[model samples]
Target: MESKKKEKKALGLAELVAIALGGMVGGGIFTILGVSVSIIGFMTPVAILIGGVFALLAAYSYVKLGVYYKDEGATYSFYKRTYPKIPFLSSMIGWFVIFGYISTIALYAFTFSSYMISGSDLAESIWARKLIAIGVIAVFALINAWSVNGMGKTEDFLVYTKLLILAAIAFIFFQNGTMPVSEFFGKLQVDWEQSHVMSILIVSSLTFVAYEGFQLVINGVNEMSQPEKKIPGAIYIAVFLVILIYVVISFAAMLAIPSEEIIAKKEFSLAAGAGKIIGIWGTRLVIVGAVLATSSAISGTLFGSSRQMAVIAGDGFFPRILARRKNGIPRIGIITMAVTASTLILVGGLELILEFGSVTFLVVSLLMAIANFQIRKQTNSSTILTLLAILCLATGTVLIFYYEYTHQWEQLLFIVFIYVILTVFSWFFSIREKRRLHREEFPK
Candidate 1:
């Protein structure tokens, strides 16, 4: 009877989907819209869709490893278990994955602040945005630290409400757009001619960061019901839904807003463009959607990543205090993540944070593909599909690097520098863990 009650209380498909969607749909569309539109023009949806395809490929390995191991540590856990001989490798993944999530957290919080204050005079003040971003992060951290069930329910509401609002936004824009369907196709043709294939591919790869939240599904395995079914089911469904949402929303924006205006407004493009096309109420609605999108994202990311952080800490890769839990919630890990993300928002520029996150997740996902490929038979993953995933993910990582090299070399250097710092931390912890093991074995 107790077991049945526990099973009943575990997260079901709906809550799992909400967690994944909450992670993916945050400030991603809002943050990428202006940047993608600037690069690919009317072909932004194509690039976004291509990004989703890549995201699906990345999820393949995650799903297999997730079901096979059923560990909430996720990427870090998978690699560690797959290659137990090399402690440093797992440590590297653990550090990179956690910081990758932190970068996304910072990205979402910053976007939240950007859209939150877009209408007010404070929008122009960087400090004001940073403070607000930090404030929102703190709020969600507390919510997550409160209880897992409360966080899940809140995420469900925020994610579904934002989706409905986004759908309505798309429909309204499509209905009000002056561009004919034929003209829309014509614009795409022109965009194809003017934009290089490499440029569109780069944008597509860059958009993968927006899809990084899918693995958060696997992170909830411990608290979830039926891992074998729900892990893959919820992840794939959420990814598909996100792709549809991003494509429809991007399509609407392309039809109703001018490319130049989108690029100029950047983070504020949706609300401002909607207001210009429709009215103040339209602007307010879009703002509400964006705020909801980011808020849920903050909550979901904190919920999943903090758990992973606690796992890594318990494994001796991070401060062990983070492993401490109050009523099964990793309060210290949640607080640490919130503080680090807040710091990143205070110091990092929006473009830098976005690009950094994209690159980090691409690297992490590629590593996951490699790990799954090695253990394909054990995980029951298709060898061919895993190989294809490796190839596609590798191509994405290279393309992003090439784009950064050609366009933003400074950002590339900064990303490299941050990795160096993380590598040092990982190596230190890996060595410490090794020594601890050695002491345990020898009893000197």
Candidate 2:
């Protein structure tokens, strides 16, 4: 009885919000800062704001579906339950979404390692970075495998601490910035000559992945109390906070660092900016904040996505072994995710991993919006908002592919190949499950 009570108290509104923030704050802002600045210059904050709007659109559907269904399976389960006739759709989402989470794990781990070695003598050693990335994933996997309560408490500390650190970094940048706020805004007008509307939209589309983890709040529905209320509450609050954080940080970086430097040191732009303005201590501060941010992201992703993976496996859409759980946690799923993400870190470069993740979640969120649109009445969702969500996400999806097609056709091809492979696997599993059900119903 006492154990049950303790378990119930493991995650509350604060912890739920922390998980969502942890997931969203990870490698997202850090990864996209230089890229956004490069593409839009002083208008990078505007692009981030637009990106946040799209995220809010995507969140609307997710929140509505989460409230209606309240399932821990989240994206996969919501779609499956909404459209029972097309089990393949659900299976495909499960596979694609899990891989999306894998891409993020790779993104966060890679970002963590990059910042970890930024000031060190081994900063340029690719092998050392990869090794550290793998090591961090392994460490977090063990932490997650140990206990849910422990993961939540650790996430709470990391997420909130990083928030404070990020705020401080922003404050320092604003205080000691090379560029004035008035000049920053003026550049938006004068710099318009250098950037086009299409470029800004493309940057905004890519920023979608930075907001990817808010849905993780839903994945913890079963662990939390009054999930219907908490899911939407935590997710909305987290997204709002993340948007503010990203926009402020982007604005600060632009003010403190030159666009050329930002583009050059794309991976560690914040740290580089801090070093220039506030010295080595400032750089070290940003790095520490980034490490904590990415660490919590890894921990939260492993916790939420592993459970979603286990739920999908239990539905027989994935290998049954993935469904195995210990101490109410999906041990096998957590380790498998860690290993796959590490392999991705080794094989894929930073930009490739970031783009793949952005595309995956954009596609997945678009699908969720479509699903929500179909059952708008049931979920008490506005038809106009749902339809608009679909349109916005669809446009974002097309913009990403367009950006990649023009810039990196090879990466786009790789993303397509991955989708084709996941589709095939989803089809095979769906058919097998269907056949088994058929046989059981009409017994030979």
Task: Give candidate 1's whole-model lDDT.
Answer: 0.90
Native-vs-model 2 lDDT?
A: 0.90
Q: Where in model 2 is the C-alpha error above 4 Å? A: none
**CA-lDDT, candidates in order:** 0.90, 0.90
Candidate 2 lDDT over 1-444, as tens digits, reads 889766845789999999999999997888788888777788889999999999999999999999999888999999899899889989999999998899889888888988888768998999999999999999999999998898999999999999999999999988988888898888888767788888998999988888989999888887888888898899999999999999998888888888899999896778888888878898899999999999999999998999999999999899999999876789999999999999988886766666777898999899999999889999999999998999999999999999999999999988888889999999999999899889999998
Candidate RMSDs in Å, in order, are 1.6, 1.4
**What is the overall TM-score of model 1 with all chains considered together?**
0.97
Q: What TM-score does candidate 2 get on C-alpha atoms?
A: 0.97
